[model samples]
Target chain A: MTGKDDVATLEEELPLVELPLDAWHRAKGARMVGFAGYHMPIQYEGIMAEHAWTREHAGLFDVSHMGQLGFSGEGVDEALEVLLPSDIKGLKPFRQRYSMLLDEEGGILDDLMVSRLGDGAFDGAEIYMVVNGATKYDDIGWMIEHLPDEVVMNHMDEQALLALQGPEAGDAMAALVPGTAELLFMQSGLFTWRGVPLWISRSGYTGEDGFEISVPADSVQLLADALCALPQVKPVGLGARDSLRLEAGLPLYGHDLDSRVSTIGADLGFAIQKRRREEGGFIGHARVLKELADGPGTKRVGLTIEGRLPAREGAQIYSGANLVGEVTSGGFAPTVGAPIAMGWVSLPHAALGTALEIEVRGKRIGATVAPMPFVPHRYRRAKS
Target chain B: MSRYFTDEHEWIDVAGEIATVGITDYAQEQLGDIVFVELPAEGAVFEKGDDAAVVESVKAASDVYAPISGEVVEANGALEDEPALVNSDPEEDGWFFKLRVADASELDGLMDEAAYKKFVASL
Candidate 1:
């Protein structure tokens, strides 16, 4: 249209906040998109090529938008245990576990990673937690209202998080920081690089073996430059990140799990250990126990579509004549070489090997409920 | 024979009463790494501006609209197993379908190569 029309469109748009590496991504030819109140890279070269590169080599990701929280002071473990379903009190030093913040009704508020830090990390902060970026502010407010005045919560807004993931991630890290590759899966330790302290964990969302490194916001650009200079490391974007996690059978918050969905229905009961289940002191323990005794009416399951068209979010799922479920996420998987999806379906229709159909653009495509992890994981775990 | 393009980015190469249709190279560049291409069945009839096919990438699925009123004569079969062909050679071998002309006058509203290039630059 006219120049006036362009100005009008710009006036209606919200101002997106830039992350620490916003300029770095733009300089490297990344396609930027508005996500979680920030300008983030959606892709660098292309999604398929980047996805393949990550699985074969190492993919570096800028995840500073995620919330990094540190907790300490009196009874921090017990305080967190009251809000989360995981066994926080028993978590050993230098160990991390996947946990979720649930409402009193047992609905998930946000899924997070909780790690017990020894004197080796973050100025002796007893607990470290990482939450989804979109829901971090809400999570913080909820915790402030629930937690006792004695325990202190520090939002590490000055720290930037990065993930170096793939089969060769260890080699890349070992080259940069000596002895860092000795950590096993779910292990974390404080390390130094060029005099800058780093807290690194041998865990990532992708099913591939990898590491997540948290560094100071000021040093992030330097670290990103150094890491990418390595032949094994390439910068990846959000597009491949989503596809890789989906193939790993990991659920993303806001899409797959929300305030209306229970912990048990998402098949995340593993996060709720036996001691936490029996003790039942958490906010959502009642619903968790009830769902455990009875059954969650709907359960999330993986689906393999038998056609070309992808079943996107909000697509209806059908079994015979009845509408049985809805797809929360679906796309063409580069690793699987087929269309794969995750959906919430009625318990009766959620069993593996169940025949189903997905309605895409008014056409029904054949789909079958299949076991998750469409691709196998390659995490480097310690031998027993 | 000359090529005509529509605002929606579909290109039509008209020769006599038979025309080959596909997306413009610019269109394929915008939709990166095509994972699938859903074409209309042969003998399918449609008026201009109707949805004729769907091309999907890793993150999104976009619809390809018919440039002019026509009847489908043949559909592209090479796209099913090798959708990346659309990304590689969208203007030539990656043609979507063939349509028998239903109304030749509809081509009057289409853009020629020079006009289409200028329009893309404006965007």
Candidate 2:
């Protein structure tokens, strides 16, 4: 069995990177906990309060520890296509596409954002990706080995990432950088705000229209402080980030998606482009395509509890008296003002509106499989 | 009027046969935000250190132990809807229950207010 000694030895050998706001987080009386290989704030004011605040108004998050890498050079799209199942050739510049890094058996290693960068045109030198923090090192190492010699991967360790999210995030961000409101969802660009260079993308994980700003490490504190000064913005911690994402119906890395689970089973088959499905070149394409065609035996679904009582992760899900599945992520959704959860169940019980039961503290609580994005997504779409 | 604390951080005010029960301020702080409280049914019999109640926080769930053996005569049912009261007024309005003491001598085994403070500080 892999024990603490093994983990400690591995950690000792591996390099650790600290985010720019490490000191700031410590100063704020944050309960720092290790997550995804970095020490991060689990809560400051408190989890529930922060979670509720993010749902109602803008919440500033220091997500600098997430892996940010850029790929450049000739045939970068083709090089990327070799690893990811997404159709990179058809991707337009400035537009970000949500894709996955899959393993040989078609299980997702991590879900990531891939943006083609270079002034509205797909230049050969277009930059390609951002992977999850926990799997970044392994991902980089894997890519370096598999990627063609001509393509160069640059890990953006010098940059710090911050997410400003919620209903009022756009207005708060636009006030800092002029004309920022004009940028549509999934579109990113280089802009200068308060003398700090920022690569801002109007995308977030909280099912809200917001910006994920990448700035130099030195200027990150200044930018975060400036944004925090806004009326709608408040510094949020990782605790809120987890609850918000759970409410948003987004899957977490280790809990929701892991080496044991497939993308089709996770309800993320939409990430696989149609052409890629036909051509079948990426890693684990055969197994993934088969799962896609045959339909998965089990699937992820949302559950809404009957009362204010929250069912937590590892809680057994039941269909009548029989055990059907297990709750992977569950919590009190601050926005919906109710308890919500997500879990994996048999394909027959995975449909929306299917009634289920969650065993909370040994008592079966009434639950129903509900459609996700429990709150409607407020992404800014391009004008027709 | 003398206050005593159990090793589990539960505080009690013993006055003859009746004893007031509540968790310590340090316990509430460590638990973060309290969202739900499951009170023991009124008149339930419990032994000293028995799991008598439950407090659910955003991050975790903890069992509130009975400080001394007794019959639970009254439970704070108001905590059902507003568990935050524990954080706001844990000592007064946030008290969990009142127990009819089965053994008055049990109070001698618990630490007094000053001793409890020193005990907490030692941790």
Candidate 3:
């Protein structure tokens, strides 16, 4: 089976979301590759150039293929609580929470964003969520089986998502929407630009201050073109997005957190809310809570290689002579100007400042376990 | 003077006893943004078409082969820090090593620039 198909089989089956600029990507000489079921641009110019461009300026990305769903009706929070370990009922409006879709065995199926949408003109008491593109259909399938009939889940397939990221992203976005800079990190609100309604979220996978604008699919091309026309924004592809996330020390769903890995072992214990830890009602809550109270046997950690050579995913990680762990994600970090990686290692060796080594093509290259966010995050937050 | 190429895309230029070895420009482009080069230790002997060095790119790693049987006389230490030189000047500054040609007749069996170009196109 093809790599994409292998992932597709593991996910809950759902329809694929096509972005507005799908044609534009093909016309730009982008190499369309299957990712998360959608034909996405892997590269346009080149991986290196695209990676550097995103780090220096702004990259306009079409992430509309990701699943965007909304839930409403009575006891929506309580119903969601049965599936996720996060305290969704306590989430305030306009605020977004990062949580995982876990299996009964305490393994992560997917990581998703859940936001409480306040009462709107059309709907009252709703919850909006965006899930990973590859696992969205499976995530929806899992939710359907668990959600009570009263809670209606509406798939926002009519919408398109765009991410504009980099240091100059805010300035460029502000010029278009005028007040987008006021949205703090992880906060979303409805706004209109030139009469096009948009749900703008101040967040991104890259460790840059950026916004994810969800707009009607029909108007996606116009919005993307408008953003690209700005001096700071350039069309970026999947190649740079992968490299940028690697540099940011963020996890890729399949490679980093999979059905085989528990949330605590993946260094995502912080995502489990304190109330959930105590109430212990969600799926896999017993194992997760126990691991939280004690600790996981292995943990994910950041790694820095000694030289220019990069350690790719699946490379063996070692502590001196012993095989301790394996590299989950790794690459040449564009922002750090060197090679960096994230891998899971034995709990004792996963701590920051711990030294380790990776065997690359038979040679044991020296590495050190370091703190995550290898580059400090520059996300835009509200001033105190 | 004679020119030879191995299946791995490495080319050798031989004159009497001394031989110059480097990867073809096509090979450099395929590898893309070479980050590391592991050259053979000087004085190491190899038969024709034997793996001699390694060139690593951001996407993958490739092995360089000996186009003609020889003993490594010198290596490119500069590539340890600036492997991009291979992409920039594959024929000149990016030459991997120099060797003492062990079997002069091996050079006769390899391809010239025109033949090598045609061979690459076939791929």
Candidate 4:
């Protein structure tokens, strides 16, 4: 969020890398900022304008900075279970699930999306994973060092990731690739367009019905241009992307989540499959089970401030004069027309409607714990 | 009346002992969209370079520093209802507040219009 191009490698003096769409974003007058290790477009037209566009129309986002990886060969699921708590072995082909990578102490290393690639796409590749851009190198190295030698790990660094999200996303995607509207949320496939492979998932972080298209680096501009040409799609920047995810109550890797945060305290218990919870085989399983049995010491909760001022990250949460917790992510919610935040607090002070105070710029602002997803999710779930 | 600019992108139009303050067009443009404006209460005293106001956009919030030591005389309450004014007409009706200047000499230290233009170009 600072002026530095990349904080992750700031001390190392490594150069800030650019995405394949760097020129394209600049052409659109995007205001680029240093995020993770990449120079990403924070906004173009404007944040409020782009945020409203995504809520009403289709907004295209360049998330190629995320690390796209593939794992294949025998015993892939068994090997993956050692790191992730999700039900990887039971994942149906072309289906995706949300999961987290945990440390030996049960603290989260990173949150990720794991999808089982359909057999029709690649004959050998079995599992597809996407990790945060900042932690990807370490994730790859960790997997390489831990997994059996028979399993092959492929980093699809040559690809660009794009998210076309909003209510009209289905219409925009179906315009380019027919039958895309039929894909339900969490479903994915390898579709061909203009003779190029497009790995698409009917899912996104905005809590909207949308598609995340993964295309070859060279073909990305073409695909982006085609999508933007549609009446429903417009290029959105990281500014709106962050606001949308904030409203959706989704946690960001380095902000809302970190190495010291457990899955339970992070409010990500859903990522742990029931079978994994009962069997207790994954890394940090004992700690997670202990929290599940005797609640976490602290828990993540949502806060709605009483005034217009935002209580940004690092703001302390106070109940009377006692410090209870600290805010991880907070900002004005464009959709809700108020300020919203997510933070971790002791279990006793984490209840909904618990009145608390957040100190912003040395002033205490009245706030209360509220239900999350300030804007209800509009995903296209499977037909019941 | 003459206008003075600060390195932080704040502008103060001084007339005798009173100064009208607001952010420059460049600051508003850099901020993207202005959703909320936090103004200091009337009669509030501030030192030169103290954070006197805050402007928040959808992406992030930024503090507006006082260009000179002064006591806030009036706050633009219009901003509370329509903060977008700061984005539309930043120099005029979008002014943030009025201050009773504590020392008129502080205005001499600020950049003039031409100097500020050159300074901004350097950034």
- Each candidate's fnat, listed in order, reads 0.34, 0.16, 0.14, 0.32
Q: Which segments of model 1 are wrong by more than 4 Å?
A: A1-13
Best by TM-score: 4
The 0-to-1 C-alpha lDDT of every candidate, in the order given, reads 0.90, 0.83, 0.83, 0.89
Model 4, B80-102: lDDT tens per residue? 99999999999999999999999
How would the candidate models be sorted by DockQ, starting from the highest?
4, 1, 2, 3
Q: What is the TM-score of chain B alone in each candidate?
A: 0.98, 0.96, 0.93, 0.98
As for candidate 3, its clashing pairs are A12-A137, A12-A138, A64-A161
**Among the candidates, what TM-score does chain A have in each?**
0.96, 0.91, 0.93, 0.96
On a 0 to 1 DockQ scale, where is model 1?
Answer: 0.35
Candidate 3 runs further than 4 Å off = A1-20, A118-125, B1-21, B24-27, B44-51, B64-71, B98-123
- Alpha carbon deviation, residue B55, candidate 4 (Å): 2.0
Poorly placed runs, candidate 2 (over 4 Å): A1-18, A119-125, B42-50, B102-106, B118-123
lDDT of 1 by residue, A1-384 (tens): 011111112222568889999999999999888777788888899989899999999999999999999999899989999989999989999899999999989999999999999765777889999999888999999999999998999999999999999999999999989777899999988889999999999999989999999999999999999999999999999889999999999999988999899989999999999999999899999989999999999999999999777777788999989999999989899999899999999999999999999998789999999998999999999877
Winning candidate number (DockQ): 4
Identify the CAPRI category of the predicted complex in candidate 2. Answer: acceptable
TM-score of each predicted structure versus truth: 0.95, 0.90, 0.88, 0.96
Error of 3 at A23 (Å): 3.6
- Model 2 lDDT at residue B97: 95
The digit string of per-residue lDDT tens for model 3 on A217-308 reads 88988888899899999888876888788778889998888988899998887788888988888998877877787898888889999988
Among incorrect, acceptable, medium and high, the docking class of model 4 is acceptable
Candidate 4 per-residue lDDT over residues A1-384, each given as its tens digit: 112122222333567799999999999999887776898888889988898999999999999999999988889999999889989999999999999889899988889999999745644589999899889998888788788997899999998999999999999999999868789999999999999999999999998999999899999999999998999999999888988999999999888999898999888999998999999789889889999999999999999999888887889999999999999888888898888999999999999999999998789999999998889999999778
Task: Please give, for residues B22-90, the per-residue lDDT of candidate 2 as tens digits.
Answer: 998888876777777778888899998888887866655678888889999999888887889999888
